[model samples]
Target: MAGFFSRSVRATADEDAGSDEAPLRPIAASDAVRRVELLDSFEAAGLGWFWATDAQGRLIYLSDNASEKLGWSDGEAIGKPLGELFIPERFDDPNKTQRPLVFLLSARNSISGLNVRLAFTKEEVWWEIAGKPQFDEKGRFTGYRGSARDVTASRESDLNAERVAQFDPLTGLANRERLTTRLTETLTSYRNSKRACALLTLDLDRFKQITDTMGQQGGDELLKQVAARLEQIVDSEGEIGHLGGGKFQIVQPDVDDRGALGELGQRLIQALSQPYSIDGARAIIGASIGVAIAPYDGLDTKELVTAADLALYAAKGGGRGQYRFYSSDLKNSVQERRRVEEDLRDAIANGQISMHYQPVVCAKTYKVQSCEALMRWDHPENGDVPPAVFIPVAEDIGIIREMGEWALNEVCRQAKQWPVELRVAVNVSPMQFAHDDFAQTVRNALTNSGLDAARLELEITENVFLGDIGRAQGMFAELKELGVNLALDDFGSGYSSLSYLRTASFDTIKIDQGFVRGATEEGNNNAAILTAIVGLADALGMETVAEGVEARDELELVTQRGATLVQGFIFARPMPNEDFVDRLANGQQTYEARGPAKYRAARKTVFRRIGLIHEDNRYKVVMRNLSKTGAMIEGLLEVPLGTQVVLDLGGGQLAVATVRRSKGALQGVEFENPLISDGAEGLCTRHRVSPYQIEAAGRPLAALPQDPYSLIMGEQEGAGSPRQFVEVEVGTPKPGTGY
Candidate 1:
């Protein structure tokens, strides 16, 4: 047997010795003999092999087991470089420099470990390699030692765990965590550039309803279908992520084209709107998309998501199944609505809601034919709030009826001051008309203001008929009896019928702007519908007012279709009472004669009446109803202030008239016809009755009441006693005038 120290070699470090590289004590020959014997014993253990290489590419030593592992005898491996058998790339620098094992030599030398997986002797086996520096007795550079083991089973287990974490198990795409990480990265990049991206937060509308009807598994199947569709839509231009549950997020990066985004959003909406067959049960689910654009809406991942969520809420609130852009203004609208709710409650108590006048002009003549009564809120702190923002809020709080009443009263009061030809139209909220007292309210408004019932036009939308039609009919009949003109606003857009027009007591049907705006398009469907609607209204004996006449072509088309009145930007936007008054004054100075076809061309052949008066200095008028051949005069004032007077009838049927007598507005006038036929009795009998009859009709003519002061308030609750309205004539100045 060999002694432990007999075969051991002495180690020495000729290089500078650092504390980490201290010299090792020399082993006795007996210890060396024992070390060799121990290495020989390990070689037989079959636990794999160990090899050592010097800092140079030289193999310093090898365990006896290396020969068995590599199928080579120890003598065959002793002189070769270890990397030749293991590492694919060897350090062949002239300096022999390497990392980790380079400084372990007195001469130029180095050692490096090979990092690789290998099947050295058998293709079925895998191994991991680890190498370290070895030293001699004096801590001088000697070699490096390496060891490796097969770790395929452990690594495979860890890899499976990682895959489970990073991917959606159902779709094999990035899961919520991975998607969120990508979102964070995307947001980080966007933050530096101030560029924009749109984050689409999509949730299937009616999903809960579907899920309830279908089982949870069915819902899962539907979600899988949605995911597949989303993947196809995203393609390579954008990225989409499943946000767990049924929600998903699509990020469109570096998108400058808004049209492209809109198109994409529409496509997504359509795609997600399709029905899915789940377990042979066909169920349709639509998506409500909320898009939040970066830079415009938010700067960070969280903020974008939040804005998207708010947009989603808005979409869902707006009847769902639609997409909406993230807008702070819309959010501000909501907050403003809250304030309006509070203000409306206070308004009801303190009566702060008032009415403002906006003149509606005739498109052809640019004359203020009517004025729409618009609501205005005077908040002590906020100043005047627009009706667009607060009206809906008022409707929500059930106070619009009171507000409507106030509007009617204000309109009636203001109408008394307007030119006799101009009408006052007040919009009646649906809530206002829903009550049984709506008709009574209008009657009271007329009675209180002393406004001519014919001049007060009440405007209601098609939906107003939905509330108790029988009651509405009764109220409408009562309103008709009071001589108030009733207009069904936005008419062609709803469930409009000839029977409704004939039986509902509506005097006018205001065609919706949507139809009228497109009426001029020759081949457009809207144009055809507009033509038909106008024809239908005319046939039903209801006058039509075409709204939104923005183009001359549209106005021409509507006029051709026999639209009795037209109002839009093509004419003029609404203006105040004073402005309308000024317009009328200017119109009087420069009279523009209307064409015969446009003035009063209703097929019914009712006479178009205009009162021409010559007044005295007090401006009291001797009124005359001019006929085709003659004039019937009734004098309230002895002489009308204006020296010349003209009657405008369609077909240029103007008749010049002079004041004959004035007995407190029992004025008499004689006509000098210029447009009608030459024979006086022939013209009178042909048109209708004679001048004597027309004069007799004005016999009880008292002085026309003065126009009342303009009371601009929203609908007022409770009944008010009727007040006398002092009508103010424009040509004559009246004392103690109030407005």
Candidate 2:
């Protein structure tokens, strides 16, 4: 080390040493001792340290102070490579722009402002180093000399500031800006390979009510709890970003399978809906998620985010606590919903809203004992709008409170004309039930109608059990005091808590239609579930009503399971109040079960155009009806049975099916694999055509472009092989008529 230090005492030292004169010391020989002292003082004061390396880039000299800092004793680091002393870290670089120390050394280039980690430190030690290559008067490579100072503290502060810029302060999750940058980069890079990614936009339900009542501090705490739960749920599969307030976004790269996405969306909804402990008080909130997959829903971050936001609007508009996948039609749904909201404000004034009744017959006798009141809206331009469609819209527009009050008063007024032996049940919205004056409103309705309180039944769903459990019990008690039967509606479907039955004095339990839908099918647990619910109700001395028994088999199963009352289409579709009154006046007491004797796979009646592919040809056909397993198509003449074909349901979904039955211009084709929900209102396949296939077919890789199938199958028409079936033009099926 000492000999190496003398190797460069003077630039011309090498030449001078061989001459007759001794070496010409650059600092005058008298000051040479003082120069060494000054350098020693710099090290002792911890201002900086000096290092020199041999021509081979091996460390020849390191100041004693620096050696001690590295826990090295007496020249232990003397022969190590200079690069070995500063290991480049994969950790955040204060400025993401720095050449590697080794690269600079190997190139014999000057290095400056380079940040590197100390290779052998117990804790991270960063250094900002600068070095210049040494050479003799002849421009030959010599090793280097450099000064280094500890920059760990300042680097940490810079990194912390960078983290602050990227993360949400309250939740410690990535902020929207960071997530947007990540999404943009992912989509841009994946465009060439056509990889799929799904983004989920979610926000808390009932969050506004919390903020209004609990204040911002309470709301912030709830948001924190939600963020923690999301971290636990998402783990490493994706990144979560806090989009401020109660909203959040998630980016899952390389994921587009609808089934998995749907499952994860549902898991998020359920987990977020669970009770949260805020400030030592229990609060309940829910989440609604909207999912958009890249290359399908949208091609870029802006398109994808807009699609996801639209889907979220649809989800919240459909009903809170649900998830919906983005579809092109959802573009119009938002505008339509806005119109619905505007029209609904005038509905009450224009008498557009009306109440109808459906009979609930005794399960054993089939005698009509109670009739549930249902709200229906008949639009002046659109005609009758189903309650399922407009009710959610009404709820979102905040008109449900007014609508509920009107319905309660009208139901009571109408019940006054009915026989006292018969009861009238009205469904109550959870939002309406949560209001402070709900019980008082009920009292006013009963008093004004002059109807016996016992004849009015209020159906309250278990969702009302969310938030303020003690308050819910108090409301239940107040309603019980009015002598109206309080039925626990949609049992076993929501907030499935036995504690509800234990705490509240409910008069009856209405078994959810979901359990009865496929209860009679072989290997289904719904039947067992129905039986268990009835037994529990019986043990609790509460009457049970089975809802939505649409078939004779469904009715028989619920009756056998000891359900006290049955309400569904098999009894009778909801009828106008005048008709209901006429039927009772004319002695129509019992409703005979008239549906199909045995349950078949439930088929949704659909009337829409779809592509039918056979051989190398595609024909347009009307899908008359669809089920998970099969679909019936029209507009094809004399289709032979046992023929395999594909149904192009759009969005890159191609279902392979075989003709199971055939009639003139109509055929029933059974799918080889059952269809899954598209995470909204439709069915879609689990897989879509890969972009790789499109690229292989002589097309550029891009987001899903329409008519990609045409490329896959070659040109559609204009020449080719002979056609098979005759294409028959079919008109739209008239309402209430079978094809």
The global C-alpha lDDT for each of the candidates, from Candidate 1 onward, is 0.59, 0.84
Instruction: Give the per-residue lDDT digits (tens) of candidate 2, residues 408-449.
Output: 999899878864358999999988998999999999999999
* Pairs of colliding residues, candidate 2: none
Name the regions of candidate 1 deviating beyond 4 angstroms: 1-309, 312-323, 328-335, 340-354, 358-369, 377-384, 419-421, 494-499, 518-525, 551-553, 582-739
| Winner by lDDT | 2
Candidate 1 local lDDT, 615-691, one digit each (tens)? 21112222234444334433233444333544333121234555454444344444564222211111221121121
For model 1, the local distance difference test gives: 0.59
Worst 10 contiguous positions by lDDT, candidate 2: 1-10
Runs in model 2 lying further than 4 Å from the true structure: 1-40, 50-63, 78-87, 91-124, 128-148, 521-523, 597-600, 690-706, 711-720, 735-739
lDDT for position 695 in model 2: 71
